[model samples]
Target: MNDAHLHMLVNHFPIVGTILGLIILIGGVYFRSISIKNTAYFLFIIAAVFTVFSMSTGEGAEEIVEDMPTIGHEIIHNHEELAEKFAIVLYLLGVVSVIGLITNIRNHPKATFFSYAIVAIAAVAVFLSTKVGTSGGEIRHTEIRSEAVNQNSNAASPKSENNEY
Candidate 1:
């Protein structure tokens, strides 16, 4: 498969993973469960790793799709910018998660602090994920673009028989 195809395959996990990790981490905090919190941390780390893969493939994918019909440098550039921000958040989450996992393992008093910090970071990551995902989708899905949607809506509206032109 080409870079674009590979990118499509691997790009979603980081978004979904951050969301899932946040939920799991919140549950862990609510229940005061170390294991659950660790699980969330693991997920974040995996998500961060996947982010690397996605970023690596993105340039190649751009090379392929940037010139395609309905796809151009501007859309890909927007997606790239958002993706970069999202990647930084995910990477920070991963590092913090590692610290959290270690602290929990050693039963450090600061473990709780890390957990809360992770929750906050994960929340940011989740927010950024939505933007990144939508921008990425817009790279290929013109139907979802605001201008395209507006044009389609206007064009698709029904005309009344007695309506003046």
Candidate 2:
């Protein structure tokens, strides 16, 4: 498949992974379970790896769709900007997660501190994931756009018999 197809395939994992990781991390912190926390850290690292594939394929995908009728350069550019921010956050989360994992495995005194740090970073990553996901969705899903939704709702409203054309 083409880069665009590959992009579509891999793009959702980072967002989904961050969300899942965040939830599990929260639970881990609550229960003080290193294993659960490690699971979340693993997810973060995998998500970060997937970001590389997503960003790499994005350029090819942009070239393929940037000229389409409903897709504009501005929208694509916005998505690109958000994606970059999200990727950076994911990478940071991944690094922090690795350190946390190492510390936990070693029974380091600072393991709890690292867990808290990972949680904070994952929180930021989750926020960025939302922005990135929305911007990316806006690229192809015109129906979800605020203006388009308003217009569609207006058009779908029933006309009064007296005003019928």
- Strongest candidate by TM-score: 1
* Per-residue C-alpha lDDT of model 1 across residues 1-165, encoded as one tens digit per residue: 999999999999999999999999999999999999999999999999999999999999999999999998889999999999999999999999999999999999999999999999999999999999999999888989989988888889976889876
**1-165 in candidate 2: lDDT tens per residue?**
999999999999999999999999999999999999999999999999999999999999999999999999999999999999999999999999999999989999999999999999999999989989988998899987767989989899976869845
RMSD of each: 2.3, 2.9
Off by over 4 Å in 1: 156-165
Clashing pairs for model 1 are none
**How far does residue 20 in candidate 1 sit from its true spot (Å)?**
0.4
Consecutive 10-residue window with the lowest summed lDDT within model 2:
156-165
Cα lDDT, all candidates: 0.97, 0.94
Question: How many steric clashes between backbone atoms does each model show?
Answer: 0, 0
